[model samples]
Structures are given as C-alpha cells and as structure tokens.
Target: MAKKRNQVRRCVKKYIPYELHPDDFLQTMTKIFCYSRWFGVAGSGNLVWKIFGILILLLLAIIEGVAIWRVIKALAGWAVDIIGHRSVTARLAGTMFYASSIVTLILSWKLSSSWDELAAFWASVDQTMAINVPPDKNLKNRMISVTFIIMACVILEHTMCMMSQIGFDCPASLILKRYTLMSHGFLLLRTDYSIWFAIPLLFLSKVATILWNYQDTLIVTVSMGLTSRYYRLNNFVAKFSVAVKKDLSRNKQSNSLNSRNEYTWRKIREAYVKQAMLVRRVDAWLGGLILLSSLVNFYFICLQLFLGITQGLSGSFIKRLYYLVSLVWLCVRVSCVVLAAADINVQSKRALRYLYACDAHCYNIEVERLQNQLSKEYIALTGMGFFSLNRSILLKVRKDMAGAVITYELVLIQFDDNGTTAHIPSQSNATF
Candidate 1:
C-alpha cells in the first residue's frame, strides 16, 4: 500500500506543473476557453481567431436561448398530459438543466468583458507575492493539485452524463443520439431543421457545458490561491513569534533585532491590506457568478434527491446509478466551492493568535493594526452582496435542503394517495 501510494504521488507530481505562479493559476482554463471560442474578445488569439470566437459566442447564445424555449414548451405539454409525480420531477429537472446553460453563458460573457481588470488584479497579486512571500514548492504543488482535482471531477461528471444518455450502440444511431442528447430536444421540437445542423449545435452544447462547470471550478481555484497567500503570511508571523520568544528567554535581545522585527511587522501589515483589497476586487467581479452558482447547485441538489426518492425503486438500474452518482458529485462540487471560500476567512484570522503570542518587546503598533484589521473586518466571499459564503451558510443550506426534501416527499405521497382515490366511484352511484 505504501509503495502504491508513493507511485501514485509521483505520477501526479509528474503531470501537474511544479512552478505555478499565482498569475498563471487559470492558464489551463484560459486555453480551454480560447480553444472552444467561448472567450474571444479577451482571449489570447490572433485577429481571425478572435473574430471566429465572437461568432461562436453569438451562436452559443442563440442556441441556448432556443433550448430554453423548447424546455418551457416541453414543460407546458407535460403539464397538459399530467402523467404522474415522475413526469413532473423529470420535467422540472430538465428545465433546470437547460436553464443553467443560459446562466453559464451570462457568466462567460461577463468574464470576457472584465478580462483586462482581472488580468491587472492577478498581476498585482503576483507582484505582492514576489516582494513578501518566499517561494515554496509545496505551496505551488498543493494549489495545482487542488485545481487538477476539481477539473477532473467536472470532466468525469460530464463524461458520465453523456454516456448515460448515449450508451454504446450502433454507429449510425449513435451519432443521431449524441446530437439529440446535446440539443436538449431542440432538434426534436423543430423537425423542419435538418439533422446536419445538430453537428454545430452539438459542439456548442459541449462548450456551454464546459462553461457551466468551469464557473464553479474557477471560484474554487481563485479562493485556494488567495488562501495560500494568507497561509504564507500566517506562517511568517508564526516563525517571528517563535523567534521573539526564544530571544527573550536567552536574554540576548538587542536594539537591532527589535528594529528588524518592527520593520517585518510593518511589511506583513501592508501585505495583508493588499490581499484584502484584492479579495474585494475579486468579489466584485465574481459575486454575481457565485450567487448564481450557489442557487443553481441548491436547486438541482434538491431536485435530484426528490427524483431519487420518487423514482429510485421503480426506475431502471442504470437510472438509479445515474441519480446516485449525480447527487454525490453535486454535493462534493458545492462543498469544494463553499469550503474553499470559507477557508480564506479561516486563514485570515489565524494570524491573530500568532500576533497575540508575540513577546512585549517584539510587539509594536503595526502588530496592533493588523490585529484590529483582521479582528474588526469580516473577510469572506459573498453572494452579490446578499449573503456570505462560510461554514455557517453551508450548514444552513444542508439543513434547509433536508427539510425541503422531506416536506416534498410527504406532499408527493399524499398527492398520489388522493389521486388514486379520486377515480373510485361511490357505492350509491353503483346501485344495480
């Protein structure tokens, strides 16, 4: 087991880059977006590629819009049929799935528009790290590892969903089914449109799906990056505190040492301020996307659970497996986003304990300022100025989702029972 673990670690280290600067944290994602033509205006591409990217973005917008309309139309038709609980739940799930595509498009557009500002923000962060934080290989490896893990999860989930929709079959129908599934039923809605159109539509659908998953991954990546800086800052303070204590105990403290410690404390305070400002800028840019992601994740989680409870036993084995995997994956992804953002808050306050641990001789005005700044200011990502993302919110969301699923299950049971009795005639009406 130990040997296997070591081999696995080596493989991971070999694949993931060793020297990842903070500014290049999103390089992989940028390449993906550029290739998919989802990020044209702000992407690093030639003039022709940029124009082609714009066209691709426009096409995606149209496709997603049409898909949303088709879903609404399908939902209306389903309501008319009024089959059962299963139909309603299935339709609702599909609606949310397609609706998410539009949301992803909006996020992608916003990111593209704000690319210049974001680039500047990253540059500023890299500059700060260069000046204050010493290079640490372990930190770089950890950040890249986190990013790779999240990306892997998303890609795996997408592949599974696609496979579930289009299982191994004959080559002729396989192409048809692949495009049909990607269309989200748009192709079916308008039979007059040639099947050939499904080719481009299918490609656009794949890109939209990438954007949908990438939004959350980006948030987690940026949060982890910010958290790393805070971790480094806290580590520095911890070491300084230890040094101060040792010097005092040995009765070797001197004016020169005191002066140096004071200067270090000042630099630490300045770095904190800069990081805090960067966090705010990031929040301003990503707050809307975060808000949308949280709400979308919450809705789908509940929807998936409701479907599982309603159809788990009656559904086919493959369907049960799909729902099980989807629910678990959704939960894991949301947790990554929430916990990663919350960690920023956790690491920021951690320095306070070390600051308080400093000896009297080592303590200075700068230390007090940092303490006040950290203690008094609440630093964490928020949902478009509405709610903050933290541990408390995560717990509350879990509790609420549980309550919601239970309530929905009970209501469904009652609904079905009443529906069954409504068809039966009274005995008086059946007299012979």
Candidate 2:
C-alpha cells in the first residue's frame, strides 16, 4: 500500500509544473509547514507583524478623529457668524457631517496605503511563489488579498463623492451622476472589506456601513450645496454693502432728486425678485430629488441590516438600530424640505419691506420695472408648483401691510434673513 501511494504522489508532482524551481518549491513548503505549527503554538514571532499592522490602523483612526473635530469647529464658527443664533440641533448635525466625513477620509487613506502594501507583497509572493519564507508565509499572504479588496472599494467611493460635488443635474450632470451612482454600487459589492477593516478594533466603526449607506457621497453633496450657499450669501452681502455705500453717498446728492441710491435700490430689488422667483422653482425640484435619494438610502440601509442579521453576524442588533436611526434621519430630511417650501412665505414678506422702503418719486422707474419683473417672476414660480402650493403667501403679505401690498410682496421674496431667503439651506442644516 505504501509503494502504491508513493507512486501516485510522484505522478501528481511530475504533472504539476516543471517550470517551478526545486529551491522555490522547497521554500514554499517549508513556510506553509512552519505557519501551521506556529498557529497551533502561541507567541510566535510571525504574529508580531500582524499586531503591528493593527496598531498602525488604530493610530490612523485616532488621527482622523482629530482632523474631523478641527473641521467641524471651523464650520461651526462660520455658521455662527452667518446665521447669528442657530438652534442646538443644527450644530449637532454639522458635527455629525464633519465626523462622518473625517472617518471616511481616514478609511480612504488606510485602504489606499494597504493596497500599495499588497501590491508590493503580491509582487514578492509571485517572485517567490515556488519558494516562500517559513515564518510568516500564510500570515502575509492572507493580508495581501484582504487589503487589496479593501483598497479598491474605498477609492471608488471617494471618486463618486467628487463627481457629485460638481453640480450634477441632467444631461451633463446626469452622465456624471450615473457614474457616481455606479461607484456607490461597486462599494456595496466591496463592503466585506470595509467590515473587516473597521470592526476588529471594536470602535463601532461605520467606514464600510457608511459607504454602503452612501452617507459619504451625500455628505459631499451637502458640502457642495453649502458651498454654493456660501457664495450666494457672500454675493448678497457684497450687493448689500454696495447698496449701503450708495445710500450713504446719495444723502449728499439730495438736490439731484435722482441719485445713485434710488437707481441702485430699484435695480437691486428687481434683480432680487427675479432671482428669488427662479429659486422658488428650483427649490421644488431640489426638494423632490433630496427626498427621493433619502428614501433610497433608507431602503439600502434596511436591506443591508436584514442581510447581515439573516447571515448570523454578531452585530445584528446594532445594525437594525442603525437602520432605524437612518430612517429617522431620512424623515427629518423630508420634513426640512417641506418646511423650506413653507418658509417662502416669510421670504416674500421681507422682500415687500424693502420695496415699501424705497423713495417713491426718484425710484418710480426702477420700482415700476421691478414690479413688472415680479409679475413675470410670480408666473415663473407659480408655474413651477412651489408658488401654487404656498398660495396663501400673497394674501398673508397683503394682509400685513396695506399701503404697498403688491410692491412689498414683490421685494420681500428676496430680502428675508432667516436663512431661507437664499432658498439654499445653510451648511448647518444640510450636514449628515
């Protein structure tokens, strides 16, 4: 029986690969053999590298946390200066957005470096496939595959967030959006790598969960939106500054009876009304898109949790709770959009105040032109479904002041200061 077994083994060896060097084959076998023995007996030197790698990852996570905190602090300061007294919840939401983004950034770094490490390791392995080191053979090989997979997923997600930030809507934006969305889908496939990279340290890490949740991508989108708001606000403040300057200069030109302030105010009011009307229309479309994306995200999280629980993972309880939390956030997002639409009424009130304040004789031409533009704008906003839904706004603005109901209504839409006149939510409101 021994002679027959030896003959079969020899036949298998001869057919395997003649190109493999005898020295390489021996080295590979020796390493595998040593790993099996070392794994059975603890405290082997081969385990030291694995311990070191884990420590490196943990340290990277800590650094990431600090960076995120700094960003949140900076954003908070900006928000305070801009809005001048936001609610507690707004601050907390900003913190979460910064926090989640920082976490994603750290994970991206780790995954990217890990991929590089794996490539080096893989090259070494292929060079010595037939001849491996005995002490850390299997230990090193296992990490190569794991790290490579993790790295690929993270890079894809980061790319998605970048594309979304560039104003993706339709045609040009739609093409990019599809690509960004595909990256998200790929990240979902590579989720197992994210899980492995995050969970071992027991920090309730959601690097993988958030990628699958598309939270990172959404945060990036919100960041872009916030940035857009910042620019608009800066422009408004600039225009406001210019208007103030013109008003100061006009006080000295009282004899002309038609100084620049009158002209500037009239022009500003007309421009403001036209832009606000456009904003009302865009708001409806933006609101719908956000709500739909939120729902999809909720569905994705729930499905992921269900799959995890069904597969008997240890964290099913936490996963389910997480899904519920995300669901609540989505509901809140929908509510914010609805409230924003309602807030248009308040915005129009502010516009009217500006219109009523203007000088009647010197600003008559500008005022008439602004009123005409407002009429056209009203048609635009009402046509977009936003104005129609909030039909009571005109009546309410008219009820508030009798002297110049139409005029006030026209101007107020663009001059409110409660963070909604711009029609874009402050970064404070959009985070997370």
Candidate 3:
C-alpha cells in the first residue's frame, strides 16, 4: 500500500487528482466524457501565447464540429457503407464514442477554462445543464496530436482483428456474430430512455469490451514466448482451463526458447517485459477514465436496483417494460467494466504465477527482475487513486449498492404521497 502511494506520488503528469472536495463529484463525472485523456498532444508547448490564444478556440470548434460530423456519419450508416463491413459494429461504435469524447473533452476544457468563464456560462444557461460537469486538470495539456493516433488505432485494431480471422479461414458465422453486435447494440442504445442514461450505458459497454479484449491480445503476443512456456511447464494454466488448454495446444509447437539460443531467448524475454510495461503505462494513463466509469457503474447498479423494486412494482406497463430493458442494458455495461478490470489483473497474475514455478530453466534473471517490478504494483486498472479496479471491487460495489438501496427505499417511504410514489421529482444525479 505504501508502494502504491509512492508509485502514484512519483507520477509527474498525474491525470487524477488525489484530493476529495466539492469538485470531486464533477471530477469523477467529467472523466466519462474524455476519449483521448490518456494520450499526449503534440505542439501543446512551443506556441506563442498570443498565436495560441487567437487560434485555440477556432481549433476547438473545428475539432468539435468534425467529431459531431463523424458521429452523424457513423450513426447514419455512411461509415458502414464506406467500410463495407458489418461484423465489426463495435469498431463503428468505438469510433463514434471517440468522436463524442472530443466534444466532451472540449466541454470539460471550457468548463474549467477559467472560473470567470464558468460562472458566466452558468449564469447564461439554466441550472439544469448537464454540460456543467468539471474537468480533471491533472491531465497534461498536450492533446492535439493524440486525436489522430486514437482515431487510427480504433479503425485499425478492429479492422485488422476481423481481417486476420478471415485470413485464417475462421468460420464466417463466428466473424459475423461479433460484427453484427454493434449494429444491433446501437439500436438497443437508442431505446426509449433519457438520452443521457443511454449514452453512458451503451458507450461504457462497448469501450469496456474493447479494452478488456485488448488485454487478451496483449497477453497472446507475449504468451507465445513468455507466459505459455512456463504456464505449461509449471502447470499454472488452470485459471481458464479450457481456453488455456486450447491456446496451449495451438501454440504447443512454437517454443521460441527451445528453438532460439540464449541470446534470442533473452531478446524474447525482454520483448515480453516491454509489452507488459507498455500495457501498464497505457492503463496508468487511462486509469482516471476507468476509475470514474467504475464508480459511475456502481451508482448505476444501485439506481437500477432501486428502480426495479420501485418502478417495476408501481409503474405502468410501458414503464415496467422500460425498466426491464434498462435493467438488461445496465447489466451488460456493468459486466463489461468488471470483465475488463478482472481480465487485466488476471493476465498479470498469469505472468506472475510463473515466478513460483519449480523449473529454473523456464525462468531467468530478467524474469526475476520483471517479477519484482510487477510485484511492486502488479497490473491494475486504477481510478485516480480512489480504488483499483478488479473482480473484487465489483463485489464491493454490489455490497455498497445494497446498503444505499435500503436507505433510498426508506427515504422514498417518507416522500410517498398517498399510495402512488410517482410524484417524486427526478433529482438529477450529481454523481451522473
């Protein structure tokens, strides 16, 4: 725990603020809206204050406009037509998500631009504006160059994954199933609910799956050389029995350690460590977003449960049906958050397990060094130091939700008017 504290303190460009205060609510909520928060911008420095001042607002508007344009194109099927692929709708959804992220980023930027501007905006607008959420200033200011890189990555990652399966002659049905999900999922997101609620639930679900699956992709690249060798030799592959067996069998003949000499073996080992380090760095950068999303998901779980017990029992048929649909969607989104958190932790654990193996040849000095480095913190999705995301955190969330629901239920009893409790004004969730 001290090491984790030190690890956080040492980060110079920390994107998450550790303080808890009035803005913490807005700080937590703002992260959901950031798409490229983790990536650094080029030319963020080197600008003359005058030139930057003149062009910054123009640049922001341009970026926000383009983001909206891309999203509209995607939602309207223009992207689908251009790409000519339906199987990777998640990719499309991701692309749109990143686009909205830009708009959100700008909103946050404007919100925190200066205290004066915020006060003026607030005065001009009504009190109910959702855009009034605050920004996390701990993020470094260089964000201009990051947008293109993220855009390319989203396009290529999903595209290449599908392409590789086709190249390998995997069954078309398997590919179609993954691709068709996004198209339908978006339609499901369009379900009749407050557009606000639908936005986070839908995007959070898709992004969570994308990031979660990415750990598998990361593990596979290293497992071919690093994890696979020892997982089998040390008999540490039981966490995921069937998938481990299948992957072990498929890669059974590809032992780089056996085929390559000590020099090449060291190279492979270094590559694996580098990949693991790279993954940790990315997680560190995205940790704020993950933390806020996880926290928000916790709130959603409580709200969903409360609505189920209250709305499901007393509301009209349409309201009940809406509750059922919203419940299912929220379940999917929360599941993705937990799965992403758990899988990343598990992948690191899988690598760490090899440290305890009996086979000396299956490990080495570099492996030991890597183990020590990982042991200090291991790989975790941390939220601005509020909490570390993992499987167990989900349990903690549910426990908290149970407690909050009981309290809310008791409160609703006081607010109840006559027999129907429907007259309660929907308090805009500050946490949302």
What would the TM-scores of all predictions be?
0.77, 0.28, 0.40
Over the stretch 1-432, how does candidate 3's per-residue lDDT look in tens digits?
676445433431122224322322223223322321222111122345325433433543443354355446655656433221221222233333343333333333332233233333323222222111233333222122222333344444434333422333446654443333322233222233344544444344344334332322222222222222223222322332233244445565544422222232233345345445544554544454554455444554554565457545443444344345445545554555566456656665555564554244444465566566557656555665677666787677767777887886565444332212221001111111
- Top candidate by TM-score: 1
For each candidate in the order shown, give its overall lDDT on alpha carbons: 0.61, 0.35, 0.39
| Candidate 1 lDDT tens digits, 152-259 | 766666555555455555376555655353334432333344567766756655655666666786688678777877887788778767866786577645654555
Q: After superposition, how far is residue 4 of candidate 3 from its true place, in Å?
A: 42
Listed per model in order, the count of residue pairs whose N, CA or C atoms clash below 3 Å is: 0, 10, 4
After superposing candidate 1 on the true structure, give the runs of residues whose Cα lies further than 4 Å from its correct spot. 1-50, 67-92, 125-131, 138-140, 167-175, 178-194, 250-253, 406-432
Q: How accurate is candidate 2 locally (lDDT)?
A: 0.35
RMSD of each: 12.0, 32.1, 21.2
Better of 1 and 2 by lDDT: 1
lDDT of 2 by residue, 353-408 (tens): 44445444334566566555544553212223423424364354335434343343
RMSD (CA, angstroms), candidate 3: 21.2
